[model samples]
Target: MKNIRNFCIIAHIDHGKSTLADRLLDYTGSVTEREKQNQLLDSMDLERERGITIKSHAIQMDYIYKGEEYVLNLIDTPGHVDFSYEVSRSIAACEGALLIVDAAQSIQAQTISNLYLALENDLEIIPVLNKVDLPSANPEEVTDDIVELLGCNPEDVIHASGKTGFGVDKILEAVIERIPAPKGDPDGPLQALIFDSVYNTFRGIETYFRVFNGEIKKGQKIKFVATDKEYFADEVGTLKLTQVAKKSVKTGDVGYLITGIKTAKEVKVGDTITDFERPTTNIVEGFEDVKPMVFAGIYPVDTEDYEELRNSMEKLQLNDASLVFFPESSAALGFGFRCGFLGMLHMEIIQERLEREFDMTVITTVPNVSYNAYTNKNPDTPFIVNNPSDLPDPSTVNRVEEPYIKATIITKADFVGNVMSLCIEKRGMILNQTYLTPERVELTFDMPLAEIVFDFYDRLKTVSKGYASFDYHPIGMKTSKLVRLDILLNAQTVDALSALIHADNAQNIGKKMCEKLKELIPRQQFDIPIQAAIGAKIISRETIKALRKDVTAKCYGGDISRKRKLLEKQKKGKKRMRQVGNVEIPQQAFMAVLKLND
Candidate 1:
């Protein structure tokens, strides 16, 4: 175990973590020339196309240093704020971290946040200044910034380029030298930490875990500490480019366990794996449960496929544990699940994955943050308002408290005004400001979580010209003036299109939603009245006139009295049609509320 190194790569998005990882794999001869590719750890097609790492990937590499063979287990983690849970899981499985910072961009929001996460884990940090090949790269200045942030000596910072493979050999040496080997007893009681799992149709669920103590062998009978289920290990292996079957995986090693378990509910992340006969006395406290920041409803396009959708979600959840969902039903969309995601991007990725991976067609409602609702009868106890309809009656409700977040935005000093104005427009209060450098600034704000649920991130990037990086964490709830804005189509409320919004921007947002729906909803035989309302009062309204069928066009030479009688009869028929006409709202209209600010 002294020659074994378990570490992970941590960085902000597009900070060359994967590229550096590629270089490391190359140096270790982990991949052949033909097998080499960009973002090799990002195996999903969606991840490659989007140029991002959505999932944490673990692989083992062998390196020879000074005639001694060393085993290195590297876990590449996603850098997006929405996937912070992934980063945390990866961190819990490792003893050290490679803090990669882009040389040109210096230290950004996610860089600082990820650094803090690694620090909290008590993991050894190796600062690597990446992208030194870029013409705009500033290694000297960035090293100073890294020194200030990490409080490490300037000599300790390694200058490397993921593009040109500069200083790649030095990084490998640092990993083997600076980082300590995993500490555990190979002969002690078996104790393993399950950090991640993925479903396989052919082999069942493959659980990836890190063995902290003792060892696990092939055909061993192990029990999951949390679920208390026993299963004989059908296969135990180390993760390479492809899983390599092994006789045994010992302490201070990361590997996979397959029991051919088909049911997804049987396996849970953060569970401990121990020998069934000689089980460990304690569970592996790997990481805390993920807290979802955004809530939305996901329903099947065809109502009959509800069961299939639930099945697919269960399997997907095995791979992506951050997604939390529960059974729910909507009046307009029928049976669905109210899902909790880390952010809007996380929600979008999950939706796309459900379509591509599971082949499930789903309709997602407008995303919002969970709120706390207090009623007059139960003023002390607060009810969770995940859906807009979950809010109690306006008269009986004492006050609605919405979730607030502490937003950290790091951007160029020139764009400070643009960012501050954007935050203020979202009803954010400036908490503090500090100039990191003469050219860079960091702004902190106390903002409503709902305000940034929509286009705030997009708008922030737009206003700052893609130079700004944003990161946020929930700061509990604050009492606020909020209203449930419901969209009524011809006097009938469509529960799926309803949203709870702040009272100040409710009218403006309602008007925008009504107008946007007017453009998307097709013209029916009768005039479709699209109204946005609060309680019994209509707040904003837009009327989509019916396609005029000229009944009078046929009778060109008819008398005025005859025309009047025909018109009156047509009007009476139209009134009856309006009463019975059920509005066919397109899927786009259900998601139009998210784009209201745009």
Candidate 2:
């Protein structure tokens, strides 16, 4: 236990954190030849599909250095900005961090941001230059930059290509040397930080924590500081990188222990676990409650799949603490849930999972930021609205404030004019600009978070010819003249299609939205009036003309089976739509309107 080192791996997206984790498990022989896998830390299908780490994963390894076996606990963290909260939780669980920086990309905005989080936690950091095998790799320059930024000796930086297994042994050596051994009173009462949790089918809820102090054993009653619930531990086990090995873990060991508690509701992430027999007086601060930044409606394509959707969401929530959902009902779509997420990527991943994993198609509404509304008459009362339809009356909402972000764009100097122009068009104000290099420039802008919620980044790439990059942090709330624009198909609110837009852009934005809706939604059997409006007055309207004859004229009784098959096909087509009075609107129609640049 004296030689045990517990640490986490942190880096920006695509910085090879998962790849490096795989190499570490391999070098330590934690994963054998038959069990070797790609991107070992990315265990979820969604993570693999999106090529991003969405959850924090841990693996324990025993590395023999100089004929001495040392237990190494490596926690792999998500690199995306949306999941930074999870990164913070994982960082809190470990005593040290291995900050991986890409050799070619040098230090990116996210890399710097996450590095600061690690430093703020006062965790020991061993800077590493990854992707050393790339043709354009500049390990020496990156090493120098890291030294200047992190205040570390350039010579102390570890150079390695996680893909090629180069210098992996050296990284292990550095972890053992630089990362401090876990220091806690092994004889004292148990105290641990609940960094992560997962719902187990057999064991109920399995909480993963690092024993910072004292020893823990099976059958001991424990107390979670956050929940104040006491439960007897059924088992204590360690991850052998691939499979759970049943063993008695002690202080400084990174492992998952099972209790009788069965659901995520019982074992909350960021809770502290302690011995109930002799409770400690000191209380460690739990992680801040993360609020979902983006909200959207999610419903099953088939109304009957509602139960499956709920179960699937519960299963996902077991591992992902970031996903939040509540019951929601739609007139056309039936029962579903209003799911909240950290960002657009997080929302998309959940929707895709419903289709792929659960075999249930989902109709999602436009994503919107949470808003606080104040009525002039009731100045003391504040109303929170997540759905645009739930917004207080336009006249009643005297003042509305939406979240804003300080956005930074790093791109070639040649595209500065184009980038600035687009920013202004999106109602973004330029804050600052600096040149990282003669050809590379960084532009800072104060932008409304709603403007870039959808395909704004894609448009930026188009304007900058794929040479531009974007990063942003919330700069707090700002007053805006925003209004909810509801789409009505013959006098009924199409719950699947609602958007919040700046009052100034309402008419034009509504027109573009109607056009996109017309393109994505199939024409119904009867003519449907697609209109977008603020309150009762309609500003933009488009007609989805009724289908002249979607069905064949033959076979009422003759060839009945063939006729039935044809009708089934036509029904399949109509199933793609959310039928409101005389109109069937496809799900894509809702998403298309959200990106209507027309």
Candidate 3:
């Protein structure tokens, strides 16, 4: 334990955290020259393509300094706000963190959010200025910003270039000298914190954990404190990019436990694992389950793929516990699953993976934030509705509360006005503003999650010229004048196109939705009427005119009575078709409203 140092790297997206992890692995000889690759810690192809880390990874490295051998356990975490929970779990298992900041970009919204998470975990933070080799690098300014934000000594900041492998050794030396060794009682009853887990077909559920007390060995019976399920350990090992088998893992050690448990549901992230027979009396603290904030319905393009989609989702959920889903049926789209996600990016990633990984084409409805709806007769029992179609009647609803987030945006001073205008336009209430530097400013607002979940990020990027960064966290529910807007096609309500919207913007939203639907829905034999309504009152309407057939074109030089009879017959047929015709709404039509804010 005295020679072990557990630390993780935290940074904003595209801040070179993965690059630094690669450099450390190269310097420690964990991966040979033949095996080294860019972003070595990022295993997913999507992660490499996007140049971002999506999953947190842990590896063990051995290094010798000053004739003393030290074992370093390094965990690389995702920098996006969507995976902030993964960062928190990584921080809980580490004693220190290397806070990486881009030298050119300096501090960002996610950088500050990650710093707060590290501080909350009471981890020793080592600020590192990365990418100093860039022509636009401003290490001095970044160093000062770090000092001001952390209130640390100016000399404590370390400068490193992840691109050039400069200052890489110095970072390892700092980790050894500054980060304390893990503390635990080796003889006490077994207690381990399961920070992460993966499902293996051959070995079943392989759990990654940090032992707080006692030891875990092969063939030992262990139980999860949360589930109270007992399983015999089939294997014990540490990760060195891949699993390395070991006879036992002692206290204060990070390793994987291969249990015969066949499903990932049995071993949850943040759950406590302890000895089954001689179980510890107290479970480890700070175990909170991840709850998804965004919800959307994903349906297969082909109705017959419903069972296949469910199986694919189940397989994916084994690897991602944060993904929540249940069966849902749509009147227009057929059977599907109403899935919950951490955020927009998470939802997108899941959809992409479902298509690319599972080879299934699926249509995703407009994403929604969970809302609390209270009926007049049951005001005390406010029910949660994730789908607008599930909401009760507007006349019966006494009030509606939507989830709000405390949003933080960092941008150049010149773009502050644009950012503020965009926020206010989204119904955000300004909380406060502070100038981080003479040229940079930070703005805080209490914004509805629904307003920003769709297109606010893209708008902010466009308005700020891609120089602004944003981060948000849930701050609870806020009561507002909210109403469910329904789209009607040929006088029939389409449940999939329904949405919860603010009452003030209902008219405009209804108009835009009707226009978009008219553009997307194809013309039929009869005019297809598209209407947007609030309750029973129609607020906006548009019609897709039927294609003209030139009924009189064939009657060249014919009698006027013949043309008249043809016209009357055509009109009668049109009337009959309008009574029995069903408007065939394409999948794109159901998704057209999502682009309204865009």
Q: Number of the top candidate by TM-score?
A: 1
- Predicted structure 3: lDDT: 0.90
True-structure lDDT of candidate 1: 0.94
| lDDT-best of 2 and 3 | 3
On residues 1-598, what C-alpha lDDT tens digit does candidate 3 reach at each position? 8999999999998999999999999999999988899999888889999988888999999999899998899999999888888898899899999999999999999999999998988899998999999999998898999999999997888889887899999999999999999999999999999988876668777889999899999999889999888888889999888889999999888999887777556777888899988899878775477878899999999999999998788778766767899999999889999999988889989988898889999999889989999999999888999999999988889999999999999999999999999999999999999998999999999999999978888899999999999999889998999989999998999888899999999999999999988888878988788999999999999988877678999888968998999888988888888889988778776566777865
User: lDDT of each structure?
Assistant: 0.94, 0.82, 0.90
lDDT of 2 by residue, 341-389 (tens): 9888778777876678667888898888888788988776668888887
**TM-score, ranked from best to worst:** 1, 3, 2
Best of the two (1, 3) by TM-score: 1
Candidate 2 has what TM-score? 0.90
- Predicted structure with the largest lDDT when compared to the true one: 1
**TM-score, candidate number 3:** 0.96
- Model 3 per-residue lDDT at 337: 96
How high is the lDDT of residue 325 in model 2? 95
